[model samples]
Target chain A: MRTARNIGYILGLPVLLVLVWWLSTLGSVNFFVPKPADLVETFGEVWFGDRFFSDVLPSLGRLVVGVAVAILIGVVGGVLIGSVRWLRALLEPTLEFFRAIPPPVLVPVLMLLMGITDSMKVMVIISGCVWPVLLNTIEGVRAVDPVLSDSAHTYGISGWARVRYLVLPSASPQIMAGVRQSLSLGLILMVISEMFASSSGLGFTIVQFQRSFAIPEMWSGIVVLGLLGVAMSFIFQWAERNILRWYHGQKEVENAA
Target chain B: MSPGTLAAGGAAPPKERQRRKAGKGAAKQLLGILGIIGFLATWELIPRLGLIDERFLPPASEVIAALVVDFGLTAFWVAVGETMKAWFLGLLMAVAAAVLLGFIIGSSDFLRKATNSTIEFLRPIPSVALIPLAVLLFGVKIESSLLLIVYASFWQVLIQVLYGVADVDMVANNTAKTYGLGRMARIRYVVFPTALPYLMTGVRLAAAVALVLAITAELVIGSPGLGREIALAQSGGAISGMYALVLATGLIGVLINMLMRQIEKRILGWHSSIRSEVIV
Candidate 1:
């Protein structure tokens, strides 16, 4: 019964929102304010149709590739820098400067060099998303247990095996936290990059529809993207849970203590 | 000044060691400067040497010259001021909404559970995805940028604030109740202090997100700001000017980040996180 009530609350707000949105547009509001039903219909037409293949797929592909590249490079770079005093000191200011710049600012520059290509979009996503992950990984690496390191050293675990088995796992939680932040950033940059270029993507489609006064279609695109964002976030959370199961156990013990 | 200083402070034990480390720190600072110099040199050389086409990306020297000219211009300053205004206003609005809503929702277990899914649903909706709606409603105005900025930053703060509020100890709450403390008194004394550190983290993150959206809105919606100026420069084929404007926005970002960090430190100085700061 309690679960049912909880579930109802979880579902009620969105249902009410959708209903209110539909009702508001029923009585002839502004043309731009699309009805919920109309948005649903349009969403179906654009997304389930062939348009999805060209626009959504490529966008998703870029997001996946960009995020993967960023995580790989960011983690490696972060570990290296975090483990080294001289390197961290030398690169701190430079990293901070680049990280400070909004990722979109780099889009036009990338466009100039790479043109309106998939690589440009991916590069923008990578540049924007890498900083959070890199910075967080550095903190995580530095924060690893000194006792754990000493124990590993005493057991004759010195190099690659030590880092692979212990250090990476110790830092995984912080790295995951950084990855979560970077996920949203990567998504935003994906949209912004596509918007800037008037190229092929969900963002470009939405802006194109809007520019032409295809209001319902534009609203549909927004809805689809929002759903996409929510879904991606859920996947990230689920993955984090699975990968950081041991970390979660440690956290629970800490909390209990 | 950053959280990274924790590692640094632990190593400075003796005066002689500290002095030696200071010398090494100076060398490290020099190395950082040299690294940047090397980067600029590469940027300058790459284009001028015809390794990369000059028309696509002008030399770093030209960009620096353009930045100098931009510093002298009133319009550039106006654009920067416009961006800053949007950033501050949007961030302020986000912080207000997040704190109020966070406390209300977090105060009740039922409300928190009920709103959990709703918040999750709304939180991940990329604010940039709302650009079409913003442009439709405001149409290339400052409000368009504000809409994006507020929407994006609100989630950053709201989630953090909620986490903070939820961190209040149950034991402390029971103790307050046993002492016959009023609801308001309990919240004021117990919840507020516990939530403050999280609030600072939220605000810091929100500040950065807000700046990103402000620039993005201007660039995408053709609003009045440095972002718009960059777009204008790009379209007008003033490559050097465009780079300079982008650099200007980046410099502003660096400043905003530094300012936010300082503010966070000042506001949360009583909190353990800030109190734990060690000077090397």
Candidate 2:
């Protein structure tokens, strides 16, 4: 009974919002605001066919590659900088300056250098997604327990073994946090890059529909994008749970105490 | 932007350690300056040596020269003003709405529960996805930029505010209640103090998000701003000018970040985080 009430509390507002939207748009002659029924129909026709394969899949593919490459670079670079005192100080200002620049502004710069290619879109994603992960990783590694480091040092653990056994495991929680931020950033960059210049992709299609005054189609495209954001977050959470099981378990023990 | 908080929250070595390292701090600063100089020298060399196409990537000196020239231009300042206007107005609106609504919703268990799923559903919808809708409604104006900026930044602030409200100390709240403090008085005295640090963090994050969205709206929607200027320069084949504008945008971003940090420091001076940092 309590579970049922909790579910009602959770779902009630969303249902009411949708109902309000439906009722307000009922019999409306406004061209921009499509009826909920029409939106549902258009969503099915627009995304459930060739466009899904041609546009959505490619966008997702680019997002995945871009985010993967970003994580690889960010983690490696962050580990290097975090472990070194002088290097971190030397490079810190430059990294902060670059992070300040909005990644969307780089779309034109990348386009100029790399042309209107898939690589440019990937670069756009990497540029934005790298920073949070990189910064967080550095912080995480820096904050590693001194006791653990001393133990490892006394045991003569150094080089790759020390990094693998001691550093990465300790920093995994923060690294995972950075990865979570990167995923959303990657999605945003993917759309922006495609919107700026692309023949095919989710962003391009949505812009195309807008230009053609296909309002319903445009709205449906947005719905798909929103769904994609939700789906990516869900996947990230699942992966994070597996990857950070020890971290979570430790946290739970600490909390219980 | 969230890194700001993480850096602050991370462990700070004790006072004696900091005092001992004081001499090294100057050396570190010098190294940082040298690093920037080295970076600029490399950028200057790359195009000069034809390592990359100079047309696509102008020499660092040329871009810097163009940026200097841009600083003197009335048109450039006008563009900056337009972008700043949108950013300021959008940030103001988002923070006001988020703080007000966050407090009201967070104060009530039923309201918080009811809105939780709805906010979760809506929050991840990237504001850029609303570009089409904004265009349809406002059509190549600052309002279009404002809509995007507000939508993007509102969530950043709202979520932070929600967390802040939830963090109120139950003991402190009850103590205030026993003192015959009314709801408004209790909120003003207890909840406000607890939430201010989180709110500051939220504002800082929102400020960054607002600037990004402002530029994006202008770049994509053709609204009048530095972003539009960059797009104009790009299409006009003024590659050097485009790079200059891009550098200008980067400078603005850096300045805004510094300003936000300053503001956060000033407003949150009495907060434990700030006090601890000072003591260290």
Candidate 3:
């Protein structure tokens, strides 16, 4: 009975919202707002075919690549800067300045340098997604317990082994947090990059549909984008759970105490 | 949602270290200045040395020169004004709506529970996804920018406010109740103070998101702003001018962030986090 109530609490409002939307739009001739049923039908028709391969997949692929590169660069660079006080001090101000610049503004700059290409879009994503991960990793590395490092040093664990065995594990939790932020940011940049001077991709296709007054198709495209976001977040959570299992268990123990 | 934590994380290194390393602080500042100069020198040299195409990547001096010229132009100021107008209005609307709704929903357990799933579902939908909808609704007007900015920043602030409200001290609340304080009185005295820090953090993150969306809507939708100017400069082959406008946007972003941080510090002066930071 409690489980049923919980489910109701979770799903009730969304169901009610859908019902309201359906009821209100029934037989309505609104140009912008499509009937819920029509949108569902259009969503499947528009996305579950050739467009999926050509536009959706490519967009997802770019996001994956961009985020992957960002994580690699962010983690590597962050670890270096975080471990070195002078280097961190030297780079922090510059990194902060770049982070302040809205990433979308770089779309034009990248477009100018790289032309209308996938690399440009990926670059745009990297430019935006790198900051959070980089900054957070630096903080995480710096925040590593002094005792742990002291013991590691006493054991003669230095160089790459120290970073791999000691620093990386300690910093994994914060790195994951940064990665999560980057994933969403990467998705945003992916869409924005596509929206500018693009011939194909989900963003372009949506804008194309809107410009051509295919209102239902445009709405359907947005639903796909939303679903993509939900799916990416789910995937990240799953990966995070696996990667940071020890961290979570430790956190739980600490909280319980 | 995470940007607040992100900012805090960036600022989190213990201040006591700075005091201890008083001599090192000056060296750090000098190194930071050197770092910027080194970066600028690298930028200036790459094109001049013919390592990269000068047209594609103009010298830093030329871009700065162009930026200076832009500072003198009324049209540039007008674009900046438009972008700021969208950002300010959208941020204000989003913060107001989020605060009001957050309190209403956060105060009631059943309401919070019911809305949780819906909010989660809606929040992940990137505001840029609604560009089509915004354009369809308002065309290329500032409303397009406003719609995107408000939608994007609303979720940022709303989620923070919800968390803030939830964080109200149970002991303080019950004490207020025991003292025969009315709901309004308790909320005004107890809940508002507790939530102010969270709200400030929300507003800070929202400000960044608002600027991003404002620029985006202008860039993509052909609205009147610096973003559109950048696009025009790009298409018109004014490479240095384009870079200059981009630099201006960066400067504005830095200023907005600094302004938000100052506001947060001032408003949250009595909060433990700020107090600890100050004491350190």
Compare the candidates by DockQ and give the number of the best one: 2
- Residue by residue across A128-242, what tens digits does model 3's lDDT show? 9999899999999999999999999999999999999999999999999899878878888898899887999999999999999999999998898898888887888899999
| TM-score, predicted candidate 3 vs. hidden true structure | 0.94
Which is the leading candidate under TM-score? 2
Candidate 2 chain A has its poorest 10 consecutive residues by lDDT at: A180-189
**Per-prediction TM-score:** 0.93, 0.95, 0.94
Put down candidate 3 lDDT per residue, B49-140, tens digits, no spaces: 99989999999999999999999999999999999999999999999999999999999999999999899889888888999999888988
Q: What would you estimate as the lDDT of candidate 2? A: 0.92
After superposition, which runs of candidate 2 have C-alpha atoms over 4 Å from their true positions?
B1-20
User: How big is the positional error of residue A209 in model 3, measured in Å on the Cα after superposition?
Assistant: 0.4
CAPRI tier for the interface of model 3: medium
TM-score-sorted candidate list, best first: 2, 3, 1
Displacement of the residue B47 alpha carbon in candidate 2, Å: 1.1
Model 2 chain B worst lDDT run, 10 consecutive residues: B1-10
> TM-score per model for chain B alone?
0.92, 0.93, 0.92
Give the per-residue lDDT digits (tens) of candidate 1, residues A1-257.
98888779889888888888778778887776877777778889878988889899999999999999999999999999988877787777878888899988888889888998989999999989999999889888889899998899999997789879887999999999999989988999999999999568888989999999998888888888899899999999999999999989988999899
For model 3, the DockQ equals 0.76
